[model samples]
Target: MRETRTMRPRAAPNRLIAAAGLLTATMTTVATAQLLPGVPASPREKGPDELARMSLLPERVGIPVGGSAWVLVRLAIEPKWHVYWRNPGDSGVPVELKWTLPAGISAGEIRWPRPEVFRTPYEITYGYADEVGLLVELKASEEIGTGARSASIRGDWMICKEMCLIGGADRTFEIEVSGAVEADATDSDRVPITDSEAFAAIARWQAQVPVAPPEKMKLRQMVEFPNGFRADANENAGVLRLSGPAGRFSEVRFLPDATPGTTYPEGGPVEGRVASGRFEVEVPISVRPGDALGEALRAAGIVCLGNARTDPAFEIEVPIGPPTAGGSTAP
Candidate 1:
């Protein structure tokens, strides 16, 4: 067994935002020290028994001018060790990426695959074990000059089993951007690019990305208080009712978005119950004192179902209204 040591300055809370009526959360890990660009850290500094390995992988073929391509920041973890998800449930930090791109080039958000639930003696967390791929989309400006180009990425993550260790790496790779061929009178010119095994691996992980809930599922909001507004609003709690096709899900669990001072009930499970060929689960929400519930609270999370590795996980964002006289409102 590999020995691990505790690290200082725990992971920071995730930030939440509601844009265009859509609830989205950005996961970030605080860095104790930022490494300068182009400087690669020696992996040996962390010893050979490190829990995870990091690398950058680009598509096999060159990119076309004014076109976009995908790059993967791959993390291969040792057995029994795991890294965190965008929302690292009870504890843990999400992987952070810092990029050094050439002029006229940009990187998009990291597209995370659905993560597994990991329970510890003290708390439950969301993370991935074995291997995980973090995909990043790279785009080139239309005015980009055709030639050879390169970019560097710095990745930082926390790996843990019983103890935690912080690890990071800097990887730089070259990008080949080819000039666009002139189009013929009848057909549009298309860039020729061959797919590699790496591309196939990315495809597999992309399928695991959570998608919006299907039409059959209906989401609603409910509020509960001991004595309405007369009682302490801090005692007030929110609930989300998700009713969907029961047969499709043998079991379901909800992982709430990570926000400071906002949390789900400790040790409480959000398991789905089946009745009349439909499944329903109520997710509880608790807000700490001085934390505003806002006029419209958007509850964002993943709805995971079943035990099979291929089981489906749907992404859901339910907008909850303020406390009403009836203690509930339609979603």
Candidate 2:
């Protein structure tokens, strides 16, 4: 089976610009829905006349073998509203990404730009309050020997604001494998993205919540949850249970290992590095109810295909998480 994960390689900051341009290509709402056949209509999300509708784009993009590819998502947002980053800080949704690939092709994890801090008298949050694009790296399958051919990628994601709404759909874009290219990414094809624009935008957002220089003890680490988490699992549903040395580090937040806030911010912002170590918390499971237990263990929060796959290497990603494997079958 193809690698079902955010497999795109990480790029240097300058390449970050190119990836942002290419991936941002699909950020805003595209009038034409990149929907799969038979998928029901997603209620139209409102946007200002000046704001062209955009869709939620995935940073985990793909390319054809022997050719270059960029993956993205488009978020069609309403006027004066925005979505959350991985570190949503107290409240806000995270953009979860999943990719479908053919043999020999590969994709990268989402490369998030810096996010702004939304502070009200009452609470502090992290995210993009307006439309923006996510960027990723996709390389073609060298195995597809030089020739005229095509490769396809499917992306699924969610877009939300103050009120939460989950939109699940698959959109596939094709790439040509011929020595001569037949199509070039442009505003007409989807949307045009520029490196400068992305940098400026991110820089501006960063200004809103710039962290001070790191302490001498700066560090970074991830504490993964056990496999059996759930909405109402053994301990407070799917919330991660923390203990031991981190017991007193009670203040908890979920942010990406790199970019602090865009992808999974559930607490406050911590620079890409931390110090004086000990951390712990109970994290939530984004997996829906009635999902197969094994598959649930797989996709719950991070949408990696590994989240769906177990040791047997059996294939079982059924759009939404699958039902229990080899258990009493549901009629």
Candidate 3:
């Protein structure tokens, strides 16, 4: 309850490093939008249904190893207007967030919710449609209480439609040491084992994230898969089945799917084109436990792409498990 707080980490590392690593593939989208004359712009091609705004929420409040205070970054949108996740799908660019803070304060990484597919005959995209808040977790420096700590944020985002529209703002936000509130610390039983109070308070953020791709995968070889990839939707499981080699996993996770409840920033349906030996599948699964996703599907369900093996070229081929009575993985 009374942890020590320290200075915040510089956002440059995340901007130059983490952010760069996540958005490399997006370069193609920028290059595709050749600023030429008479491109036959379709309805402002980049015109948006609504404007997007960003703010912070106390709901994700937390105190880390240090006495630092943390909060959530909330991105609100007008109806039907969506934004891209860190890893944007095939045809769109990602929304980039840059935070500016004082010496003692620091910010956490942006958690990406799984994405809905945005399909076009040519390209598919991954992003959110309508109202959703992207949780920007933060930490206040321990020194803030002793002295003073503050921070500012500069975010850049490109909201897209049929064509891409780039929009960014250098907005000023603050986080200084404040007096303790009246909330009571959780008792022994109710308290979480490992910062559950912090996690539970923030876990609500999970609500807005996209459904994660399957963690368990058995698919064709890398050399044989197609660039466009293959997809099969299993509404019964509320999951999209992607067919691709281990390396192709990254693309699938970023691209959009056609699930009903899901939404994508780029307009249109996903393009399906897989190489002869390689195929990629995208399935939608409820990240939370005990959902309505069919039982049979759940038994053999592959839920998320773990950090260790989430790369586009990543691969995992389990030796065909010992043959079962039916010679198949139970479904």
Candidate 4:
């Protein structure tokens, strides 16, 4: 099978100027949505707006000064239609977020939930189905006064099923800022008094966020390519041996994110399997010549156990040291 990568389009210079003006002026709520050309909506499928509904939900009733408040960018996707994840695997663009925040307030990166794997004969992708909530923490400066602040966010995504449709929505929110949080208050006490359902939804998605592997389940090293990794080596193929308790998981898979100047071979022997008390995955690494390497020397991906949505997943970064002397390939 051939691997294909999909990327989001860039705006022209004129469009960039117009967008900058729009962002600086006022963020108008775009009620309607637009579909990308060529890929028409199927008769059985819903329209762009109907396919995905974007809304904002706050974790607390008021933002605490000198502290951060969590707000969820909830996407209620129609059944059978899905939105891409941070990696988006072999194809598709991940959902993008653009925020217009009040002065003295800043937005944090979206904490992505675990993504489901979607595979077909042509390509493999990772994304979400049904409802998915993305948590974005908004931080306020200590000098900011207590009052109500207005903020707006826009979400752009590519929802696909039998056909793909690019769509976006704008959501406006009024955030209430208060004094510093009390030192005696417990974690639960800081939760939103209102929006019980929203808080629960955020908590649910927060639980799905991938975390580091436990101490007992840490990766030891690569077994097959012990001579060290060479980005310029011929047919750079090896096995990533993860030492962990096995037999508990029936399936194992690796969903790779984008790494500049490097690529992972897809399909064929390039897959993962569980054996003994370890999870071993065959990784075929290829890289461009004379590449300026820094973080690119390390391989990063999500190691999924059993079912991606329901089972436990761990985020791993394997260091690829320099090749053996003379920059030779592993025998």
Best-fitting candidate, scored by lDDT = 4
Candidate order by decreasing lDDT: 4, 1, 3, 2
Which run of 10 residues does model 4 get worst, by summed lDDT?
Answer: 1-10
| Ten contiguous residues with the weakest lDDT in model 2 | 306-315
lDDT at 133 for candidate 2? 54
Candidate 1 structure quality by residue, lDDT tens digits, 62-122: 4555656677778888888899999887778998899888898888988888888888788
lDDT of 3: 0.40
**Per-prediction CA RMSD (Å):** 14.4, 14.3, 15.8, 12.2
Clashes of each: 0, 45, 49, 0
Q: How accurate is candidate 4 locally (lDDT)?
A: 0.66
lDDT of 3 by residue, 79-186 (tens): 555677554656566666777766656677776655455565786555766544556556554344522233455555666555455555444533324333223433
- Per residue, candidate 4 scores C-alpha lDDT tens digits across 221-321 of 34245445555655454454444554588677676667654567775223477787567766666654345345545556777777757577777666555
Question: What does candidate 2 score on TM?
Answer: 0.39
For every model shown, what is its TM-score relative to the native structure? Answer: 0.71, 0.39, 0.45, 0.76
Task: Give every collision pair in model 4.
Answer: none
How large an RMSD does model 3 have? 15.8
Give residue 77's error in model 2 in angstroms.
2.8
